[model samples]
Target: MERRILFTIMLTSFLTPFAGSALNLALPSLGEAYGASPAALGWVLGSFLLAAIVVLLPFGKLADRYGKRRFFIMGNGIFALTSLLAAFAPNLPLLLAARAAQGIGSAMTFATSMSILTLVIPKERRGWAMGWNVAVVYTGLTLGPVAGGFLNYYYGWPSIFIVLAMIGGTAFLAARRFLQEEWYEDTSPHWDKKGAVLYGGAILLIIYGLSQLNSQPLAPGLLLGGLVLFFLFCRYELRQENPLLPITLLQGNLPFSLSCLAALLNYCGTFAASFLLSLYLQSILGMTSRSAGLILLSQPIIMALLSPLMGKLSDKYAPTKLAALGMAVISAGLAGFALTIHNLALWLMIPMLIITGTGFALFAAPNNNAIMSAVEKKHYGLAASLLSSTRLVGQVLSVALMNLILSLSWDGLSLQETLLQNLQLALLFFALLSGLGVIPAKVRQ
Candidate 1:
């Protein structure tokens, strides 16, 4: 039963990251097919992330109130359906809408999966289970580019969505058949509708505003409005008996809060590295999607191999220290990228990717163990959801930063030159962000 449950959760875990990394390799193909500008391509990616971030916390709370298994099944169903729809989308607008809906499905699965894992697994082996979970996620990342590139090269970008749909359907069936137990913290039927609206609205405005930085007249206004709404959301949550998010978690829990902050900074600094690198390889170096993907596989391969080991080490050592060390390693890797941008031979690029991947594995498993360990069993769903939310939010910001940089740099240079400049600047900025994150990771109680 334990193995089955772990297998099911691990299967579901593969979907989102696979979709993300695979899509990264396919971006250039997508842009050419749709005649999309870099800004529009950013929208294609950002739409899914924004939708996921807005809904994750709410779904997490809902999972706690209702049942994790029920929502997990439903999420897989929604994801499968949306992947099919995305495959058939004729226009960019339809595709974006499908991706947004898929994001909602991703939130449901992500919000509940780790919570369920923590519930069923014994305390002693929890880190090991979590480690394997993180490893499978990297496995997905490892396969996505390779598979997505192969499919895109032979069939078209649409085939990628078709494959995702099949995988989602398989996971849905497996979860429903093999996982019979339902886990719920609160059986109350009450819903926090107002809090949901306010929180969702704030995230939408903020991410949209950031994506439009220097590109639109209303960017500043949208950002200000989002901040105001966020403030209101925080105040309102504090007053509610059944809040959408537990305000006290952030206000009172130092370790949990700092772990979350570290996650946010870590993802913000590293998530877009693939996005930038994909474009650099395909657009700048004129490599095919297949070739670029093969090169990109170097990083996640290391991540997949090392994550479980890191998870085991975290069980014995201080997770906080390990996480802090990971952050420093990540900062070094990002700096390596920036410094070697001018002379990116395969020898240099592959080593840098391996270093970054190792850092990611070190950080992800230990940091996750820290976050889950900080909360009680009842708050597991909420903690999982919040952690996932922070990750998606950071990813959105990372991509938005890249979009802003690309828009700013495209004025007077050739496309290749512009991309090179964007790569250097973005890597430096991300290195600094990762360096800053180490402080929070180190100080977490």
Candidate 2:
């Protein structure tokens, strides 16, 4: 039963990230097919992330009140359905909408999967279980670019969506067959509608505003409005008996708060690496999608292999220290990329990717263990949700920053030159951002 539950959880974990990483390889193809701009291609990715962030906390709270297994199953179904719809989308608008709906499903699954694992696994083996879970996620990322590239080269970009639908369906079936238990912290019927609206609205406004910074005159206003709404959301949540987020967790718990902050910084710094690289390889260097995907495999392959080992180590050592060390390595890797961007060679790029991947593997599983371990069992769902939310928020910021750079620097230069400049600036900024995370990671209890 334990093995079956782990397998089921792992299957669900693989699907969303596979789609995300794979889509990076497909972006140039997608842009050419739709005659879309770089910002628009960024939206294809950001829309899904934004939607997932909006629903994650609410779904996490709701899963705690209702049942996680139920939401997990529903998420799989919605993801599969949306993938099918996205495959047939004739226009970019329809495709973005479908991807947004898919994000809601991803939120459901992301909010619940780790909580379920934490509930069923014993303390001694918890890190090991989490390790394998993180491993499969890296595995998905490892395969996505290769498979997505191959499919896009042969059958077109729509085939990637078709493959995602099949994977989602398979995961849905596995969950139905293997997961028999339902887990929930409370059986409450009361809902926090106001808190939900404020949280979701704030995230939407902020992300949308950030994405529009290069084009919109009112972007700053929208950003300020979003911050105001977020403040209101936090205040309202503090007053509520059943808040969307557990405010105390952030305010009172040192380890959990710092761990979350480290996660946010790490993701913000690193998540855009692939996005920038894909464009650099294909658009700047004129490599085919297949070739670019193969080159990109160096990072996640190392991550997939090393994550399980790091996870097991976290069981016996100080996870915070491991996480802090990992963040420093990631900063070094990003700095390597920044320094080498002007005259990059495969030998240099591959080594940097390997270093970055190693850092990610070291950081991901242990940081996850730290976050989940710091919280009580009852807040597992919320903790998982918050972790996922932090990741999405960072990812959104990373992409938005990339889009902003691409938008600002595209003038008066060739496309290749523009991309090179963007990559250089972005890598430097990310390296500095990642370096700052080490302090919080080291200080966290």
lDDT of each: 0.88, 0.89
Model 1, span 400-432: residue lDDT tens:
787777765567888777779888899899999
Query: What's each prediction's TM-score?
Result: 0.92, 0.93
Clashing pairs in 2: none
Candidate 2 lDDT, 1-445, residue by residue in tens? 9888899889889998899888877999889988999878887887898899889999999988889999999999899999999999998999999999999999999999999998888877788888899999999988887788789999999999999999899989988988898887966668798999999999889988887887899998998999999999999989988788769769999999999999999999998888788777787777886688789888888998999899999999989999999999999999998898888565677999999999998899999999999999889998999999999889878877877766655669886687788888988989999999999998885
Locate the minimum summed-lDDT window of 10 residues in model 1: 402-411
Off by over 4 Å in 1: 25-41, 279-289, 406-422
- Provide backbone clash counts, one per model: 0, 0
